[model samples]
Target: MYAVFKRELMGLLNSLMAYITIGVFLLATGLLLWFFPDTSILEYGYAELTGFFSLAPFLFMFLIPAITMRSFAEERREGTYVLLAIRPVTDWQIILAKYFACLVLVVFALIPTLIYYYTIYQLGLPQGNIDGGAVTGSYIGLLLLGSAFVAVGIFTSSLSKNQVVAFALSVFICFIAYSGFDAVSQLFVLSYFETVFLSLSVNEHYQSISRGVLDTRDLIYFITFVALFLIATKAVTGGRKW
Candidate 1:
């Protein structure tokens, strides 16, 4: 798993995908938070990243899929999956190694945002009037949300050999998982099942946790969502050999 993890990470860095993802995330966040004078968070009265966090998940709709589209699709396209299959590694390990590699990239992409915290801190009206607990909670929520999206992307990537198809499917799945249920629940036809559907939606839990409440139910929802997709990927890959 470690070897696979390292290899995957090295590949991302070698191709500069990791750098590009992080750079884009930072550039977008920076522009939203500081650069654009009219829409900048600094112009707003809120000290916390209410604007930043609210905008990020939507941006990640594209960015996370872009980062994860190649995870297994590229392997299958290059015919390296067979080589991986002949190795001693279990499918679980292979899935996890890829998942962890993507997670590492997500964390790497997020770490640079700490600078935004510092900037906000220094610029706060009372020298850090920001809610520390709320910021921490939001960051945790963001990580969980990203993890679930990564798992979804990986599963979608595993379903296709073409990276473009994988990317498109990933984005569609991510967007739907994140917001589809919320949209569906609003429709009159689904009104009877509205409560049930909303509960199943990713955005519901994300919004709950984003409020800085740290609800265990919301966290469990994210963990289970990620695990479910990972398991589905494993089942799909296993079926390929059978």
Candidate 2:
């Protein structure tokens, strides 16, 4: 497992795609947080990172899929998945290795955003008047959201040999998991089950955590969400004779 994990992580870090993904995420978020009038914190005249926290998941929706699309898809397309399957690692290990590798790339993309936090901290009217707790909580929530998305991407990548198909499927599933349920709940016809539908959205739990409250229910939901997709990926991969 350690060997697989190392190999997977190194492979991602070594790839030009990984850097491009990180660069794009940073560049886009930077623009949204500091330049884009509508979402820009500077325009809001507030020392809060609310703009960033709110906009990041949307970026993750596309960024994570790009990172994970080739995890299994390329391997299978290139006839290397069979070679990998014969390795000493178990199916779960392989899935997790790829998942974590993609997640770490996501983390690398997020790390640079701390500069925004620092800027906000310093820009606070009283100097450091920013809501540190809320910022911390938002970062935690974002990480969990990214983890769940990574699992979804990994599962989708396993389902197709073509990277484009995997990428598109992952983005669609990530969008639905994150916001589709909430959108459905808002429909007049679904009013009776609005709570149930909202509960199923990644947005709901993410919002709960973003408020700086460490709710166990929200934490559990994220864990369960990630686990389900990882297990599904394992199942999909296991079905193959390789």
Candidate 3:
């Protein structure tokens, strides 16, 4: 597992697309949080990073998929997937190793956003009056949310041999999981089920924990979401591989 993890992570780091994906993520976030006049920090007139958190999810919708689209898709494309299946590693180990590689890249992309946090912390009237709890909570929430995205991406990647299809499918599926429940909650016909629907959505659970209060339910929800996809990927591949 560690060997697969190292190889997967190194492969991404060595690729030009990986750098471009991370670059675009950082650039987009930088523009929105600091340079762009509309949602810029200057316009918010506050020492909070709410806007940054708000925009990150949308950015991740594509950036993460781009990173993970090639995980299994490329292997199948190059006719190496069968060889991978016969390796000494368990299917879960392979899936998890690739998943963690993408997660690390997503985390790498997010690390630069700390500059936004520092800037807000220093720009406060009291020069560090920022809510440390909320900042920490938001970052943690983002990491978990990103991890979920990586899992979704890997699942989609495992489903197809075409990287483009993998990317598109991953993006659509991730978006639905992230926001579909809230949409269902708005339907009056499903009003009775609204609570349950909202509970299943990543956005709602993310907002719950991102508020600086860690809820056990929210943590379980994310972990289960990730585990489900990882297990599903293993099951799907095991069926065909064996």
Candidate 4:
């Protein structure tokens, strides 16, 4: 598992794809938060980084899948997955290694965005006047959301050998998991079941956690779904052995 983790991480770090993905995420977010007139902080006349947190989720939906699309898909396509199976790594460990590898890259991409926080901290009216607690909570929620997405991407990657197909499927699954429940809730007027379905969606949990309140149920939602996807990926790989 360690070998798998190291190799996967190294592979990404050494490749242009990792740099490109990270660059695109940062550049795109920066443009939206600091450059785009309507969404820019200069235009908002506030020190808060609310726009960044609000916009990041949408960008991560595509960025994560692009990063993880090759985890298992390329391996199987190139006939390396069978080689991986013959090694001593257990199924879950293998899936987890790939999951963590992709997640670490996601984290790396996020680290650079801390500059935005620092800039906002200094630019506040009273200096460091920003909503520190809310910002911290939002960052944590975003990281958790990204982790769940990594699991979804890995699961989709394990489903097929075509990278494009894997990318599309992962994005679709992530979108549904992240927002589809809320979308569905709007179709029905029943408040009771609508709330239930919204609770099942990732956005509901993410938004709850982002409000500077750490609800046990919200954390559990993310962990449970991430585990579900990872387990599903393990099952897929175990049966295929490819």
What are the TM-scores, per candidate, against the unseen true structure? Answer: 0.95, 0.97, 0.97, 0.98
**Residue runs of model 3 more than 4 Å from their true location after superposition:** none
- Model 4 scores a TM of 0.98
| Candidate 1 per-residue lDDT over residues 1-242, each given as its tens digit | 99999988887767676678778888888888887887688677677788888888988887888888899999999999999888999999999999988888888888888888888888888999788887888898899999999999899989999989998998998889889998988884546689888988988998888888998899789989999999999999998943
Model 4, residue 152: distance off in Å is 0.4
**Model 3 C-alpha lDDT per residue in residues 52-79, reported as the tens digit of each score:** 9999998999999999999999998898
lDDT of each residue in 1-242, candidate 4, tens digit only: 89999999998889787789889999999899888999999999998888998889989999999999999999999998888889888998888899999999999998899999999999988999899899999999999999999999999999999999999999999999888999998986677888888889899999988899999998889999999999899788888884
Give lDDT per model, in order: 0.87, 0.91, 0.91, 0.91
Ranking of candidates on TM-score, top first? 4, 2, 3, 1
Q: Model 4 misses residue 172 by how many Å?
A: 0.8
Q: Where in model 4 is the C-alpha error above 4 Å?
A: none
Candidate 1 C-alpha RMSD relative to the actual structure: 1.7
- 1 against 3, candidate with superior TM-score: 3
Residue 214 C-alpha lDDT in model 2: 94
Q: Where in model 1 is the C-alpha error above 4 Å?
A: 188-192
Which clashing pairs does model 3 show?
Answer: none
Q: Model 3's lDDT to the true fold?
A: 0.91
Candidate 2 accuracy as lDDT: 0.91
